[model samples]
Target: MGSSKAPSWSDQWGTGGLGSDNYEYEEGDKLKKSSSSNKMSSAKAAASAGMDKAKSAALVSADKAKSAAVVGAQKVKTGTFAGLKWFKNQYQKRSSK
Candidate 1:
């Protein structure tokens, strides 16, 4: 009767080492990213810039509204003072007569 030889470790696993040799990769190498990732980064940057612009515009609009309110208040005060002066002048003229 002939004695059959057992298979070696390399023959049972593979010659390339881990799994298959079809995949090409190296240790410590950065992983390749798809174009979609780059596109998303660009979109995020644009959105951030847009938000900054909107915030600046809102601040400017608020400042303008505050200035307008101050000017309107000044006008009302000036008009009331002028009316009081006119009334006092008329009363003095009538008493002297």
Candidate 2:
């Protein structure tokens, strides 16, 4: 059999074959770009869902805290009024004596 000449770099890479401003990329590169774009979209969707869940949890916690604060305020008000009434009764008894 005759000796075969090896293929040149230009022929293998398609550099000076098609035309100017026409660069050829491998199939693997195209597939990688597509797969990366899909992964990015999926990640964005997951992050958005997580943020919404966190926001709902924070709102529920805030509502519970507000209810507790209101109950505490009412108790303080009731205790203050009872103490004032006791003081007034003591003053009246002392004045009568």
Best by lDDT: 1
lDDT of 1 by residue, 30-80 (tens): 222234566678889999999999999999999999999999999999999
Single out the weakest 10-residue window by summed lDDT for candidate 2: 27-36
Q: How many residue-pair clashes does candidate 1 contain?
A: 0
The lDDT of each candidate is 0.70, 0.70
Steric clash pairs (candidate 1): none
Where in model 1 is the C-alpha error above 4 Å? 1-36
The 10-residue segment with the lowest total lDDT in model 1: 25-34
Summarize candidate 2's per-residue lDDT along 1-97 as a digit string, tens digits: 2544533445545654323223344554221112346666888999999999999999999999999999999999999999999999999999999
Q: Top TM-score: which candidate number? A: 2
Instruction: Please give the lDDT score at residue 34 for candidate 1.
Output: 31
TM-score attained by model 1: 0.54
